[model samples]
Every structure is written in C-alpha cells, then in structure tokens.
Target: MPPTPIRASLLLAALLLTSPAWSADPVHKEKVELTAEAPTHSVKGKIKGYGTAEYTLTGKAGQTLRVQLKTNQPSNYFNLRQAGKDEALFIGSSGGNSYQAKLPADGEYTVQVYLMRNAARRNAAASYSLDIGLRN
Candidate 1:
C-alpha cells in the first residue's frame, strides 16, 4: 500500500529529529598555546545557533588543569573531555563554570563551548571568555 503524503512528511521529520549527529552542528577548533612565562591562556568567542567552539591543549597526568568560563548567556556552558574519549570529564551546565582538577592522563584535552538544546534551537547567540590554566 502506498503511504500517504502526511505519513512520509512525518517520517522524514522524525528521522531528522532523531539523528542529530547526521545533521551535526559545526565546530570551530583552536589550539591553546601557553608560553613558559605564562601558565594561563585566555580566549574569547561567540557562538550562534547550534555552533560550537573547541579548544585543545596538552598536559601531564599529575598537572592540575583549571578552566573558567564567563558568558552573558545563562545557557552557555562548557564540557571537558580527553581526546579520543566519548565521555566528558566535566559538564559546565550542571557543574558550574569553574572547574579545577588533576589530569587523569598525559595527553590532549578538549574544552567545548556550546549552548543548551533549547537555546540552540532558538538560534540564540552567546559571547564568552574562557581561561585555561595548568600547574604542577
């Protein structure tokens, strides 16, 4: 039996909604650089709609890593994850903006800035400053 036009449209919408990765948001990536004289690096950016910004840095296992975010949008948050890992070490929305912890491994780490789904869907814009610090 041929499906009705309404059914086809509804099915397409459902697929699109369910497959967020298939229609994933764009990500802007940057490397964090800190010289020997400075242990901290600060970066500023703006994210609109569903876009995200990713910052990558390297650290040792025993070093303490600190990340602080200041943003005008309440829904804007950051997540910290080790490269090649699926789980997040920190989720800023639930854990708050300031994070300090000892590194779990010696490798590359990523800090991702984004808005919550609700705010993202509304095409909201957020301006933020992120500070990354590393210490022994």
Candidate 2:
C-alpha cells in the first residue's frame, strides 16, 4: 500500500527523532593554528552540558604530537582520534589529561573535549585550556 503524504511526513519525523545521531551534541570544530616559529599553541574555551569541542591539526607520520588539557570540571576529558574515525587513539578519561605520541599517519587528527555523561546530564559547564604541540 502506498502511504499518504501525511503518513510519509510522520514516518520521516519519527525516524529523525529516533536516529542514533539525533541526540548527539553538535560539535564545535576548529583548526589548530600555530605560529611558524612556535611548535605549540594554546586554546582556551568553555563548554556546557553535552557540548563538544574538536580541534583538528595536520601532521606528518613520525612527528611528535603533544596535548594537555586543564579543566575546572573533573569529569571533563578529551579524546584523540584520526580523521573520519570513531575509535579514539587516546581516551583522556582512561589515560589522563595529557597525551603525547608520535603520529602514525600523515593526515588530520582531531582532539575532542567533552564532559562525561553524568556531568553533562547535570548541565555542567567547563572552562578549559588545551595546549597542543607538534614537533620533530
């Protein structure tokens, strides 16, 4: 049976409401910029509730990458992932707030800062400083 226009609209709305990504918080993305003479950059920002901040930086394989996060909220943490990938190379909640590693591939990497579910549910806000560095 062919569905009516109203029925199709209702179905679409339902699908959208039930989609896994629908409830996910919108991400704030920014490209990490560094001065030509400095290998490090510092960014300070604030986030509330389920908000997320993603910092993307490009690097070459074998280059060293360093990231340090300081936040007021204890539950706030960060994750490091390669571009277009869901799995994290480093999960700050489990690994602590500092991450230093040699790049495995030549591409963009994202450092995502977010609050844990418990804190986010309480509408927690965090002010954070993220220091990122890339060097040989």
Candidate 3:
C-alpha cells in the first residue's frame, strides 16, 4: 500500500495540532548600580543641589521580580512602581542604606531614588546610590 497526498497532509496537521507551541519566553535577571553627586557648596559653605537615580526592569508573564536599593547616605528615599503607574508599590525613608521589594506579576517596572532633604533647608548635602535586580 502507498500513502496518498491527502493522507500525508492529514498526518502533518495532526502532529502540529498536538505539539506544544514553543514561544520564546526568556527569563531575565540582572542588577544595576547608579551614583549621583550633590552640587558643590556655595560661598557661605552651603550645598545647593540634590541627586537622583533610576532603573528599569523587564520580565515575562507570571514571572517573579526582586529589587534591591542601597545608598551611601542616611537621608535618601527609595521607591518602586510599575513602569507607567503613578503610584509606588513600595517606599522607604530614613532607614538603613539597603532596601528590597518584589513584583506582583510580569511586566516592566521602575525604581527611583532621591534625596530626602533640600540643601537650602539646613545647608545639608544630598547624594544617592542605588542597586536593582530581577529574577524569575
């Protein structure tokens, strides 16, 4: 017996229908570090500038994400939020130089850090450092 063209087509169709789709969903994990310097002091020995740092992370659907932030100064503030969201999921201030948070679902996210005080307020100086990471 010989296989017909129609039969071959049917067999191919069945195999494709039963096979699992292999979409390339890559898992990504990485870390970023940033540093910013405060503006120089004025004639009266008053510092007058602030610094900021930001990081962006991407993930697959249902993947878990972890983020960590660190600063050299004590008065720095850290925040995490979805890429386009206006509100932050986590925030910390006046704590140890290190902070961490986890993402609820897959997508893009951002981490932001800024100085806690204005230099003019009390002639204080502000600087920031940050570290960020993501995992499946």
Quick one: RMSD of model 3? 18.2
Better of 2 and 3 by TM-score: 2
- Model 1 over residues 1-136: C-alpha lDDT tens digits? 9889999999999987796664777899999875558889998999988999999999999899999999999999999999888899999989999999999999999999999999999999999999999988
lDDT (C-alpha) at residue 127 in model 3: 43
Clashing pairs in 3: none
What lDDT score goes with residue 131 in model 1? 97
Q: How close is candidate 1 to the true structure, as a TM-score?
A: 0.80
**How much lDDT does candidate 3 score?**
0.49
Candidate 2: regions farther than 4 A off: 1-24
Candidate 3 per-residue lDDT, tens place, 45-90, comes to 1112343445555655454444444444456565666766777767
lDDT of 2 by residue, 1-136 (tens): 9999999999999987785875677688999865448889899999889999999989889999999999999999999999777789999999999999999988899999999999999989999999999998
RMSD of 2: 4.0
Q: Could you tell me how far off, in angstroms, the CA of residue 44 lies in candidate 2 after the best superposition?
A: 0.6
**lDDT top scorer:** 1
Candidate with more favorable, higher lDDT: 1 or 2: 1
